[model samples]
Target chain A: AQRVTQPEKLLSVFKGAPVELKCNYSYSGSPELFWYVQYSRQRLQLLLRHISRESIKGFTADLNKGETSFHLKKPFAQEEDSAMYYCALLVPGNQFYFGTGTSLTVIP
Target chain B: DVKVTQSLRYLVKRTGEKVFLECVQDMDHENMFWYRQDPGLGLRLIYFSYDVKMKEKGDIPEGYSVSREKKERFSLILESASTNQTSMYLCASSSQPRGLKLFFGSGTQLSVL
Candidate 1:
């Protein structure tokens, strides 16, 4: 079965510190990965996708096929970026699967 | 702009009562999904509909049922609301070619007492 895994339950970083949230998936074929962010009192929204290879709000994720991982990274953490991050996968069907999510806290 | 809205932001109901959570999308999406958010479970798909009057069971669909009588509306039904069923329910929709990239609504926080 195809599954998405986010290993961190809570990730804490200081302002201007580099942050990396680890995610690994189990899949045999090409993967379509996405990063979704949920801020306090806000809906979960799409941040970026691996297919687009673009950066949203200074955060970028690279898809590593060999390792079967798509880790979300940011050079300088911001207070506004502190939110619950979820990684999702798209398989052959339109059905989607999501990770357990990582709660990021950027301390000042 | 695409928009998905849940009918209720917060609801409190008693046990054994029938509860209905309504969702509507104005983007004319073909796919709509219902999920329950828990602390460690993240988002567990409860049910989904690909089109009007068509529904499919998700990973955990035991205590819940769905109705998609219209293209823009999907309703989640809980036959007998229980304390364990109290959760943050979310509604999301997407297009067919857009694949699994979903646009979500502000979730409904349901409390069963």
Candidate 2:
């Protein structure tokens, strides 16, 4: 079975501090990974995908096949960056397995 | 932008009542999904449809059913709503089978009392 795991349930950081949300996955084949974010009262939206290799909102995630992890990171946290983040893994059948998100709180 | 619209933002209902959550997308998506979001469970897929009249059970489909009569619409049905069933329901759509990105709707927060 394919699974995505986000170990942190909640993370607190002061503004301007570097932040990292850890994620690990278990899959047999090559994986397509993604990070989705939901702001307060906002719908969940895609943050970044490993395939795209692009940064969104100063957040970037790199896929590490050896470790089977795709962790989300940001250089400087902002007040507006506080939100719920989810890690997802896409398998061969167009099925997506999502992690039990991490709630990031950027304190000023 | 792709638009995936869920019919209700918030709903309160009594236990044992049958519930219907409607979702519509204007993006001509080939795949649609229904998921339930809980505080610690994140998003658990209840059902998904690849095409009109073709539905598949997801990770958590025991208490729910789905209908996809048309390509643009997918409906999730809770045959018997329970207090434990109360959660935020989200609907999403994707353009193709290989597409990893999905467009989501404002979730419907359903509370069973």
Candidate 3:
């Protein structure tokens, strides 16, 4: 069975500090990984995908196949970056498995 | 811009009452999905339709059913609403070749009393 795991339920960091949201997956086949973010009172939206290899809002994620992880990283955390982040894995048949999500709060 | 709209933003209903949550996408996407968002559980797929009149059960399909009579419209139905059924329901749409990118709605917060 394919599964996405986000270990931290809640994380707090100071502004300007490096932030990392951990995401790991359990799948045998080649995986398509994505990160979705939801800010307060806003709709959930796609943050970035591994395939694009493009950074969004200064956030970047690199797929580590050997470690089965696609952790999201940002060099300097911003106050606005505080939000709920979900890691998702897409299977062959259009099925998406989402992680439990991590709530990030960047304190100023 | 792709727009996925859900009929209601917030709803309050009594237990045992039948409930319908409607969703429509304007991008002419080939796939639509229904998901329920909970605090710790994240987003759990309830059902999804790849085409008109075609539906598939998702990770959590119990206590729910779906209808997709039109290509751009998908409806999620709860046969009998229960207190445990209260949740934040989200609707999303995606197109083939770009199916990985999902456009989501504001979500409907439903409360079953």
For B1-113, candidate 1 gives per-residue lDDT tens digits of 88999979999999999999999999999999999999988888899999999999988899999999999999999999999999999999999866657999999999999
* Candidate 1 clash pair list: none
Candidate 2 lDDT by residue in tens digits, A35-72: 99999998999999999999999999999999989999
Model number with the top DockQ: 2
Please write out the lDDT profile of model 2 over residues B1-113, one tens digit for every residue: 99999979999999999999999999899999999999888899999999999999999999999999999999999999999999999999997858688899999999999
Off by over 4 Å in 3: none
For candidate 3, the per-residue lDDT at B77 reads 97
- Look at candidate 3 and give me any clashing residue pairs: none
Evaluation by DockQ, superior candidate among 1 and 2: 2
Best by lDDT: 3
Q: Is the docking of candidate 2 incorrect, acceptable, medium or high quality?
A: high
Q: Rank the candidates by DockQ, best first.
A: 2, 3, 1
Q: Give lDDT for model 1.
A: 0.92
